[model samples]
Target: MNEQDDDRDGGCGAGCGCGTPGREQFVSISRPSDAPSTAGAGATDRHTIEQAVIPAGTFVMGDSSGDRNAGDGEVPLHEVTLGSFSIDATSVTNDDFARFVDATGYATEAETFGFSAVFHLALAAPEEDILGQPPGTPWWFGVKGADWRHPGGRNSSLAGLGDHPVVHVSWNDVQAYCDWAGRRLPTEAEWEYAARGGLDQKKYPWGDEEPDAGGTWRANIWQGGFPGTNTLEDGYLTTAPVRTFEPNGYGLWQPIGNVWEWCADWFDPNYYRASPAANPTGPIRGGSRILRGGSYLCHISYCNRYRNSARSQNTPDSSMGNAGFRTVSR
Candidate 1:
């Protein structure tokens, strides 16, 4: 409980809840179509509401694999039984979010705050030109005009990236989107259950297999280096289109490597010890909400938490270039 206070609530875009105001003005924006109709041409087509049913079963949770690198939060591998529930097979895409934004004229927390965190590489501007950087990670720059539409900054666009997961979305933004869609964020247990994809106690979405096996690149992750340069050996400098890789046993796409998805629970490092045997919903209150799976930025040298048991935390309103969410239904 003495860890760095997680940003569970009471803030704006991606920080300790301090930023710009005047969100009511967003109502002036008119609704638009579902992302220009060409978001995913010749790409995998799936219903926006399509979901896979995760059957009721008991599965081992956390790091039982003896990975010395695993964090303390992943320890004491326990068992959890969850009832039948359904979840979106993929992270919410730009097109999906576009419909929500158009319908409600909802300005994301980032837009309301007038800025959001962008991967430092995204700026490509002279160091002096960048406005500022977060205290913890300088790699995360606070770039002006960065939101869901312009993920990089003022100049970027979601043109061909419509099929990609919508980033620069705060936890609050995802909650509103889920409510409008008549869906809910998955609990940490449910998320890990679905993420395991019927495979019990395995690292990554597919058994213990390495991401790049047989010279076939798997998930989209930093290839060459972290914070400085990326060789893009995995065919992406940042996010790749949803369904870019094969699905897991439960027909889930990119379960391990993609934008970190928000979970419906307050994060506690010690929660697993007392987690329910039937269905655990995490702590009643905490500093931060839970984030699962790794992102395009995850690498072995830094954050390698792309496994079924790996977990991370962030403030409820925190939005990042590598953060996104999915939804579930009872």
Candidate 2:
């Protein structure tokens, strides 16, 4: 199917052709033990993956009249039907990822490349120099020793950040984790539906009102100028605990902020036009995969796509400071 066809239903489409460069090639990453027995632990224990029961039903998928800045790709609100399934209630955290890495010895894209791009604002020094930087988005710098474990590179550790959503993961890394855990990434439709928490066409997981409701914060997004200034008004200078913010109606945490979660579908800007209205899996074949949920770096000035309906794309091998994932099962 064409990109326009997939875009019609909130699945990744136009820019995700299968032949595109950097699409991930799946590799086996060994699974760790089941879920942690205790709640609110300093580190996430490997608990059995919890499945969210998304009852078979329909919900409005996009924006048409509201959100003036909503991209053309997210146009023409449509209906989508999904089957019942369970999803992880929280985004994968650093501890959860650490176990996976320890078990498989599987090197991540960032680990293989010896560095990953981190947002300037997330770095201690914005002007720090690094070699072989890629073009575009001057705010992105390649930091050596940066990975899921050391988010900002050397001297960084997940010690206190165990409960926080893991970052610096690529689509390939997410897939490896999913395969090992006997789970799969949610389809784009499934992700958007769960993110909405049963609300229809709301700008965010919570609702249309901006989180700064009368000067109160709702989610963990960038508060001030992006790539430069950060007011840290959200009580977080970086990633917050996965459960730091209030959960959506579906009891899902960090669905709108903290970090972007990778989804199964390949990304194509124009996939929704002719996309199937029921349980769309995205185009059958494509390159870049879809990532949902805005990251802590999200700001209205640059990338405010933290809403349930918001979407973004990434090369399968591209990992960054604000990218990670969750999983689902049938």
Candidate 3:
């Protein structure tokens, strides 16, 4: 799509308020590219796909209990039915992302913008300077030079993080990669179904219990304070390897924590109330896309969207330090 068409359709475009001033205007999008495949002859061997078979059935969607503080969007938990489909067993890893980048030279929104919004604990600043940083729960700061390759910014590298879930990717970027791979982003129904791993109406992929099952770590999540103090009891302060945690019954790992995966649905909180009982696809159009799973940055003090029924939204063109995606094929 051309720049004008992209902006109109909310596809990938340059002026999405994501790029820095005076930087190159190249749009980091995941649209279909004519560029040759970068999946070298060896690339095929490096990647593996785990399938999650969702049976055709119906289940309740959204929070059964209401969040008094929640907006009107996520209301009236309703029923949704979905046909059988398969989903990736895990979030897309750095290695998988590297293949897409190699083939298309596809820069992520963060790469093109020259930085990304990173949690404060991930930043290096003097005690005094920390107080002067931009305010957002005192944890999120717009750090320049942060991307998938250099997650923590210029001084950081992905040398030891090749197995970690790829970050700094926008929904549009993930969609583009899926298209190139002859796959597609999973609809919200499909994602929730896969996330549940065949379970019905449970708070998490594993169950209602928190990841700290009897004082044992079940997934990678923020241990201490929301953005500042992370004890790292989970053995990670940031993103962990994609398969670092145990898989659910359907063999899906990190569906509740580690990183948020983009869904194909346009987010409308109350849409679930009026949604079809079978194969709901969300609203026809909206300002943002739906994101599933919570990231390591999630905390109960603030954003508790890590639950399987919990949902979040973001602009399709927006990229963040903890955003990535996986794919599903028919």
Candidate 4:
């Protein structure tokens, strides 16, 4: 077995509580050589992507619930106004990505790098195919042959996951998909506003109620214990179907949990301090890009970032099993 070190670009912010202090929400190795850029490759098929129109309006942005993790930059409780825009009804599914792949032949960064970070409990590949775990994040393992197609590991397949959100994709990879789909990632401000589901300053997309309110699971997340027991109380160990949960008032599905959705802005913890009042796109430049919504691995004990105003980020080239993206109308 070839043991690999966690050669990452930087440490994770304090937002995602993934057990390890200051570790990234997902592990990312060194980036491979760049693949040919594929922007503006084709026009978007409206039939393939269902969109929900978020009417133009202004709303207070950031963590109003006061449940924000320290240093997550989800504060200052600033006001933000955004123009009318349309967002994906659900995250990009495996079937959708497969169609994009079949049409573009574009290689994702994970495929280019030959591996991706997989949750240790969800490992499906043989022991021989296991690469190594990061230094502090024992819950995650760097598995060879892990990509969007093989989310669990080398032995996993997309047999019944056609409707599930595609995992193991990077910000850079989403750009290629956008080029082929003729869509762009939502700005951080836009993502927050739409995720609010027309509600103002609520803790979740469904108001202040907890995800497990009334013993009903509103989102897919770790149920039992972090990194050890899941109990599958939410009926999912890795990822649930993109459209499994009830849609928000805006008709957006599972905007707060499922998988981390990439946004079209560079991540800056202090961006909210000086964010523009209208359509604030994040920083002009930064090394890490913003990621919104939590993933299936999120738990109250470990990662409780599955809130409306919750935020996280990773390098543009990073890819992991708990991350994917949805697109906005260009």
Candidate 5:
């Protein structure tokens, strides 16, 4: 990556993959525990996660559309072959996480850190719970008591959000969830392959058509002015239910938009230049982990990465309201 590219990546922290800014002021330096928990041994029994079984296939990976982010290493589109795998039909929901937490007694990194990134407009806690905002991005605030349960802050609860994809989960937290559920995050290549949904290099899972084709919204994305005014044209100001949109050919729902989903790969913009054609996992080591599928905050003017081949990265321990993850069978 070039100097300017480095600056752009640094500007947006954990949540910026979906347009939510990161908290640079309060960096989460300490890593969370990765030990597997014996609890939740019957997690599969409690929640029968619907998974889409993608047959082994080869498809071009990376962006062919001109919408690719500059310097995001989405260039030099290459063919990738992946083996058959089963992935959750939708992003992990609040109910799923709640079961894991209740069984394992696990505390997400955000809960351990005592604060997490929350969009300014979505702030639901008392003024005292508001910590501060990052330097460049004023729309994000570091709010205390903001985790998966209290997504909007201390006052927020998962009362009506049981089906919504769980937010405020860090990459490390996902590890715990996977450990309990006996699953793993999909590789970036696997994610893109399934996200394509049998289509070849299409801009979206459905097609190259715009998200709002013929005045009908396909995915949940920012409909109006970003950060300032959201007209709610897409029927939601924030995240919609995990299964809100139409399923792709592979029966995956909302693969491109709604919330940024975590991937099992360390990011390297230049890795694609030398990536193996068959089942390429990211780099051997890197500071940040991969985040795919931009969220509702995405707009064409800013962070328009809500596409099949778009990519973003953040530190493993950072958590925010617009990011979550789905899992593949181990």
Candidate 6:
């Protein structure tokens, strides 16, 4: 089957809860703590985000959810012990990225490439003006002038989204931010460990409960429909405020869904079989880097990596409106 830009691993309208590929939902997100968080603190001459400390420990990593929705890459459940470390309470935000750009006069990969892929619905252009959509994925279009600053298109702006996680950022772009911020992206193991929020074998940060068990929309995801229509049942059409959701057990915010977060390791689907018992950094070298958590684009009809342990990847230079990252420190 030819790959389409928006084509998911499964065709449209698929659902999974038993570790199979599908969709799930939740309630109005609220911050659990009003205490000033240490998530974004920095270490002088570099930007620092308040971070939550994840103590050193071992947890069952990889797929054991028995989730019929899970993919082959997440299989072969294994134990992974990770050292305690601190991670940003949430993914890096627009204001955060703006600071990086302003301090270094940096240009993002989208700017360098002169274009990036955009969700078709986010576009307001005449149909003919769309550069193109990748084969098979008709929902994604090549929209010019769609960078981090102008996420939707040329007409979009960052005026009120300073607190939103920065998108249209590639893995390469995140590396630069880490360098300047004096922090590093979480290793794949660390990311999963942190995201689990001290839970053992749960599909989401909050446990096995369905994402939308109550009347509330827990994470920001496509509600009513996938590509064609977003019912906004979650009260957001795109990114939600990074601090919108309650913290996981470890005081980290919104670990399961929002924007896909970049990890430091290169991606390898079968790496788990040979991965280290402790602190696996991923493949020594690979074509793409890992992205964890799902984005607003995820839905039951398509991708559902929003669950814990579900993962995706992109080339080091690939940037998209749904991509972002967070940081961890030694």
Best by lDDT: 5
Model 2 is weakest, by summed lDDT over 10 consecutive residues, at 14-23
Q: TM-score for each prediction?
A: 0.83, 0.82, 0.81, 0.91, 0.91, 0.85
**Per-model lDDT:** 0.72, 0.68, 0.67, 0.80, 0.83, 0.73
**Model 4 RMSD, rounded to 1 decimal:** 7.0
Report the lDDT tens digits of candidate 4 across residue range 88-197. 99999999999888876788887887788888888999987767766556677777898999988888899999999998888989988888888899998999999999
Candidate ordering by lDDT (highest first): 5, 4, 6, 1, 2, 3
TM-score of 3: 0.81
* Comparing 2 and 6 on lDDT, the stronger one: 6
Please, what are the lDDT tens digits per residue for candidate 5 over residues 192-221? 999999998899999999999998899998
Of candidates 6 and 4, the better by TM-score: 4
* Model 3 lDDT per residue over 1-330, tens place: 001111112111111111111112222334334433333223233346676676787776665433212542444556777887778888888888898788678777666655565556666433332212232233455566777887766667879888788988878678667766767789987887788876777878887787898998987778886445789999988788888878988788788788888899998756765677778878999977888787886666555667776667777766666778887774
Q: Give lDDT tens digits, candidate 2, residues 148-247.
A: 8878776577778888888888887777777666677899899989988888878888888897887888888887765577789999867898887687
Q: Which candidate model has the greater lDDT, 1 or 2?
A: 1
Of candidate 6, the 10-residue stretch with the lowest lDDT total is: 18-27
Instruction: Give per-residue CA lDDT, model 1, range 128-232, as digits (tens).
Output: 435566554556676667889998888888989988999888777887777667778899999999998888888877888778878888788777767687888
**TM-score of model 2 vs. true structure:** 0.82
Query: Once all C-alphas are superposed, what RMSD does model 3 give against the true structure?
Result: 8.5
Per-residue lDDT over 1-330 for candidate 6, one digit per residue giving the tens place of the 0 to 100 score: 111112225432211211111001111122233321123434534655687989999998875555423243675678888888889998899998888887777777667665666677777545644566555465676666778998888878888999999988878788888877778899988998998888988988889887788887678877876668788878888889999868899987888767888899987767877888988899999877788887888776655678788777767777777778899884
